[model samples]
Every structure is written in structure tokens, then in C-alpha cells.
Target: MGVDQNSIWNLHNKLPSFPTLNKNEQTEVLIVGGGITGLLTAYELINIGLKVMVIDASTLCSGTTGRTTAKISAQHGILYDSIIQSSGVEQARQYYTAAMDGKDRILNILEELKMDIDIEQKDSVIYTEYDENIQAIEDEFRAYDTLNIPGKYTETTELPVETKAAVTMFHQAQFDPLLYIKQIIDVSIKQGLEVYEHTQAIDIEHGNEIKVTTDKGHEIHCTYVVQATHFPFFDPLGMFTTRLIPERSFIYAGKNENPHLKGMHLSNDTPARSIRTAKINNEHAILIGGEGYVVGKNKSSADPYKQLKQTAYTLFPDHTFISQWSAQDYNTMDSIPYIGRLKNKYENIFVATGFKKWGMTTSATAAVLIKDLIQKRQNPNENLFSPSRFELTSSVPTFVKQNSHVATQLIKGKVSDEGKSIDELKANDATTLFKKGKKLGVYKDEQEVVHVVDTTCTHLGCEVEWNTYDLTWDCPCHGSRYTYTGKVIEGPAKKHLKKEEL
Candidate 1:
């Protein structure tokens, strides 16, 4: 029963917490999240003598940063071909350069600080098993050639699975993400980076100055703000929630003294699997990940860990399962991330999100681009990642299709009333019940105590379904999630669910 809680990074790194926001604060720049993007942005700003403040609803490095597979590579799983087809060859080159720059920046910082953070360079590969995906792999190789990227296609790989073809990008890397982030945080603190943890940013009021209101009734006034909370908590631009598609992917680790490969590898076929190496308990281990589906797509609320267990065992039968975890990410209509001004009119407000699952390098790319924009420097890559750069023919149809799917989910949520009664549920079980014209999500603990909460999502009023594996209420519409006891765990939901006595 390994689950999302058992990430290998969490076992090795623990971040110290900061006091919650207690009083009104003012700063030149405010970063509303303390994940990798926010921290890196703070690091960059503080070094340039700008007064920067970073606040996290939880502790630093406690969000998606702690949950990633930690692959630091420019090779984002057969992406160049699609980018070239969608944007152009020049834009594809820029995207490739941006990814490499992100990797190089991290390497340079690590070398300058001389942090022993278990960093190692290796080739990244996107391989395939099915014959149908071979042309896609070949097309990716052709795109690499057009972009002058240092990569090659091969028929064989070091993986235990029989990959028919693969494309490899050299000089890529993997590292302990928390360890790398911790060094920047330490340096940022010394450089006067004000970091507050356990402080939830509820909403932002726009006037002459942006007022970021916290759940504790304190407001942070800042000339500039970056919403780097995976999903934008406050979307005045109204573009994020509509364009971003929330997805959840699973990761599992196991003990293996001798594992398959020295590099990061991803399968291009269906039920895609990614493999990389990690150090666990002074022994070698292999991390197998990737079984991504949009949040709330599963009707059974099926645990991804079951399929992951089968994948791990089938690939590395000698290894013993150690941990399992899941991470959430947002995908844009296009594959590129939105990393600059939230709107064309608002120069002071910025946001960085829609990283898809390739966040290790994209996060750094975002930090650098956002920093350039705040300093009023012209970033060449801005147009490539612009939030407003919508392709009428390409993106409009996708936008409409995504919203149509959402409407379908909303309609389904309104009509469906199909859960066992709360009295019939057993301990350690959850069920959604329609009682007296009210939809209630009830979960009974091992101690036979029942916890009940209103099942409507606070973000868009979508009816929330019980996730049995993770013990949370998940939204089918926009992927907002909540704890069984009605606490908000993820967004675009900013408010906790209504509580009810059981």
C-alpha cells in the first residue's frame, strides 16, 4: 500500500517551518508560493537588491517540489517534434535553449556554492515499445537535428523493458531537488529574503497597489506579485483556470543494488513509464513513475499505486517496493508553460504555471523569465511562453473542448446520487450520501468516528467525489481537492468545505 506520502525526497530532506503571517506587511516584490519557482525567483531578486518576500501555505519545499521525480534534463519526453509542428523551428530552438539554460543555471549555482547535493549528469531518453510510436521517435530526432540539439536515436537501451526505439539527449542530470532548493533558501535568507510559512494567501485585491490578503486577516502590499502555487490561487486574468488542465501522476521507489540504467528514461507509449535512479538508506534504488490521468477521471477512485506496483515488479523483479507517491501538475493548451505577465495590461502582476510534468527545468526557466520581466529587461522567450499568445485555430478548439468536458462533469455531478449510506459504511471507509436533499461526504476512521463535510467544491461549486485511496474529496470539473474533514488541500479551491456533524 505504498502511496503519495512515501516520496524518496521526503525521507531524506526536512525543511524548517516559518511563523505564519501575523501582521500587515509591505514589500517591493511578493512571491505567493515557496516552491522551486518562487524560491528561485526570490533568490534572483534578493541578489539584485530588491526587497522580496516569499510566503507558503505550508512549509518551504512541501508542495510539488518535494513530490517530483527530480529529473533535470532538457529532453522532455518526445516534445521537440510537437513544438516544431505547433510553433516553428525557431520557437522550438528557443524552447530547447530555455530548457538547457535552466539546467545550466542550476549546475552553475551548485558549483559556485559547492553544495554536495548528490548531483550527477546522465543522458535522458524517450523510448517506445510499440511499433506505432517509432515514427514519432524518428520525427523527434529530425526535430532535434533542425534545432541543432545534441541527441541521437537508438534501437537499444539499458532498460530491462524491451524498448524498440529511443531518442537520447546527452549531458542531462538528476539530483535531490529538496537538497538543491535548501541551498538557495539558505543563501536567500542571508541575503534578506523574508520567508513566511504556514501562511495561506487567500486572494488578491487589485487597486493602485496589489493587496494580497492572507487567511489570518493580514494584507501584504507589493508592487509586484508572482502566483507560483502550481495552480494560480487568484486569477484576475481568468486565463489560468480555463486553459490549465490538472493532472496527477504516480511515482514509486524500490531497493535495488544494481538497477537498470544510469540515466533518466521515459516510455513514449500508452501507460507511459519513467525510470531513474536514487539513493535510499545508503543503498541504490530505482524510481519508477508515470501513470498520469486528469484528476477525477477515475470512476472507481482507483489507486495508481496498484498499477505502479505491477510496473515496478515487472521491470525490476529483484527489487523490493519501498515507497509510492503522487504529484499534481497543470498542462496548458499548448505544451509550453506560462511564465510572464498575467495580462498584457498588468506589468506588475506575474504568474508561472502550467509546467505539465516536466517541471524540473521548466521551473528554473520560469524563474529566470519572470525575473527578467520584473527588472524591465526584454526576454526573447517571453512571446514563446506568453499567456495571451493564443492560436485561434489551434488553441481555441482545445479551449472549447476542455470547457465542454468540464460542463459535462458538472452536469454529471448534479445528477449522480450513488453512494452507500453513512450508517452502512465500515471503519476506514468513505462514501458520499444524498440524505434529506443534501450531498455529504462521510469517512469513518479506524476508531469508528465518522467525519462528514459538504461535497461541493468551493472553487467552482462542482460536486466533490470521495477519493478512497488518498482519503480526500476530488473535483471532476477543475481538479480542486480537499481533505476528508473539509480542509482545502489543493486549488483552484481557496476555501475549505462546509463541515457537518456525523
Candidate 2:
């Protein structure tokens, strides 16, 4: 069978379709993204008799929402220990509470819909393959204990490997994410949600009212706006780009006589190891994820998917690679996600992102928090996740580290060695070369057709590096991704990379 390059969730499910915006329209709420977060928020407001419209750059839920391993749990690696130390115990408890609330909301929806999507209640575990990481696990478990969370510390887990120690959170769940999204779309549409696909919200003009301009020149005038795009595509304060860090992780899924994970398991090791199973349409596949790297940090010839697959079989022995894909997620400067309103000035515009790869649980909470904000209700957790509330101590170090690395990447990309000229470029490969001091990316197709684009990242003038694994040009600075043809895929960069003159 040919390996599918998309998330295993895409199989046997077709999402409800919507049209591209053709003309200016008005609504009470305008959601710029049609993914899980946006849709959940839309459903909440629409159910309360508010006019809500959702727009997506491409198909709904086609971004990070579709590409997840779909572990709907509150356990996000060894996170609580750091959060408790950085913030307070109350703040840490609030974070845990919000995550659990989000997880419960997902389950409640599934029960209300009574749909079967291979939902399984399983314990979620964090283990360490190395001795160095065991202390981190012990600290996290202690944090969990202090927070009154249901968890236990152990010396090892159920995975077929040697481990220093582990931590387990009981009764977390997993399912086919896309299937659940399909049901959410159904429930949302019934609540009178207007959705627009292939309609990109490009610019936001905030005056007496908020007006969102799309790529098609159509505008959405609304009382409130929500930027639910994985990264805030429109940042007025220029804060999000600096505050958020993007990383990419790979997943390999296939059939095995015995799946490695009895429960969803993650190793607390660098570059991480995540394992889960997806049983859909009576077909069972074990998914092994995590050979990850920060965007544009290590751009070389090696493929992450191959490494993940090789690692899978070495551990599972009977692992068969049926499908493979990659997912990109953003981590905030602090451990907590930046939910709630975008800024004090733009109070009418709310934003929810920086899930830290735990969106299945976090996105649901974000939706509810955004709804409370819109309805003028006070949510206790609002201040904790506010995008504008920057903790100097927790965030400043990350901020300095991220921007310094950005500085290094920006300067490094300019002075680095020029790659092979167009004639010397290999078929079905890509490179960056300098011609007349103009850095350009060159890609030769299977048919030997040469395509070139200016390697300058449109977001902040940083250089774009060729990512062989995803076959896209990635900005080492802020995680803007583009096609070999130079079309914008993921962004902080809204514009397509300019084609070079060759």
C-alpha cells in the first residue's frame, strides 16, 4: 500500500463543506480559523443566539487540528513542575482544572452525539528512557500530588523498552480526532454557524467596529473577532511572533499484532517519544510519534519520518509502516497557553493558541474561555491565560533565547555557503544559492523542471531553509512554512515567497 502523507484521522471521513466568502457580510462574531478551537467557540456563541461566522484559509480543521495524535488528556509531558515553580500553586491548579474541564467537555459532546469513533478510555503515562530525566518525572509527579491530580509515580511503564521511571495519569482518552471533528461540525451547523472555506482573513481593521479583510477582497464586519489560527496570523502588537515558538513532530502509524502502548505513552526524553493507537472502521493501527525539532533549527538531508519509522520497528519488532505524517505546534514562552483576548486595546478581538502540542484538551477550554469573554461573564482562569499578561521572569528568558536564536538565524542565513547552481542541482531536490548576492531557493522536479524563489522570509526578512522531511521551505526564525512553489503553507508570513528571476 502507498504510504499516506497525511494524519491517519483523514481516512474514511469527509467533513462538511462551505463556500468561500464572495461579498462583505456582517455578524456578531467573526472567527478567522475554522479549526477545532474556532468551531467550538463558534458553536458556543451561536448556541447562545449570537450570529457567528467562521472562515478558514483552506478546508476546515485542515491545519494542526487534523494532524494530531489525538490524545485527549490533561497530561502535557513533564510540564506542571516548571509551571508551579514559575507561577504559583494556585495558577498551576487553575491550569490543570482548565485542562480537565476541556477533556470533560469533549467527552460530554461525544455522549450527546452518541457517535462511535473508536473512543477508548486509557491511562496516560510519562516515562523516561534516560536516568537524567527521572528526576524531572519525580518532580512532575510531586507537582501533581500537590495539585490533587490523580496520578502515580512508578519505576517503569508498559512499553517494550528499558526505562528509568514513569508517571501515570488515570482515565484519559483517545479517539479518531477527525471523526469527532466531523460530529462537532454537524452539531455546530445545526446551531446556525456560517462557515467559509478557502477564505483567508488577511487584515483586521479595528475602529468603532472590527472589519476583517480576506484574500478575495471580501470583508467581514463584526462586533467581535477571534484569531484562532494556529499562530496568530494578524498580530497588531507584534507580540505573538516573539512570544511563541514553533516545533515540528513526526508520526508513523501501521498495524501490529500487539500495539506497544496499552495506554497513551510519552517518553520524557529529548526529541520525545509518543505512542498511541487508532482503531477506525474496524482497522487498527499503532501510531508512534516524536522525532521532533524546532522549526529550521536543524535543516539537513535526513528525514524525520524515516527515523520515526525505523525507531518504531526497532522497538515494536512487528511494526509495519502503513502511513506517515508530521504535525507543527507552538509553545508559549511560559508553559501555559495564551488564551483569552488578544490585547487590552483590541478588547473585541480574542485569540487562542500556543497549545504546546496538547490542543485536544486545551482547545476546548480555550473555546469556553473565549465564549465567557464575549458574553461579558467572568471566568476565573481568564487572567492566567491572557495573551497580554506577560510574566517577566517565566517568559523573559525564553524571549531572550528565542529572539537571540532568531538573530543568529537571520545573520547566519545571509553569510552561509551558496549551494550548487541551478545546472548542478539534483532532480527532485532543493537548495539555497546566492546569485548576485540575492539568496534564492531552487527546486528541481522529477521531470527536471527548475523552480526558484527568493529565500528571504516575508515575515521578518530572515532566511528560509529547505526542510527535506516536510518538503517545504521553513523559516528558521518564526516557523513560517512555504511550498517549493513558494505558496504560503503555515505562517506568521501571509504573503507567498516571491519567485526568483533565475
lDDT of each: 0.84, 0.85
Candidate 2 lDDT, tens digit per residue, 224-298? 999999899888898798888998888888877746366899988876889887777776688889988888777
**TM-score, every prediction:** 0.96, 0.96
**Ten-residue region with minimum lDDT total, candidate 2:** 1-10
Off by over 4 Å in 2: 1-4, 258-260, 299-301
Residue 376 CA displacement from its true place in model 2, Å: 0.8
Kindly report which residue pairs in candidate 2 clash with one another. Answer: none
Query: Clash pairs of candidate 1?
Result: 3-324, 4-325
lDDT for 376 (candidate 1)? 87
Error of 1 at 207 (Å): 2.6
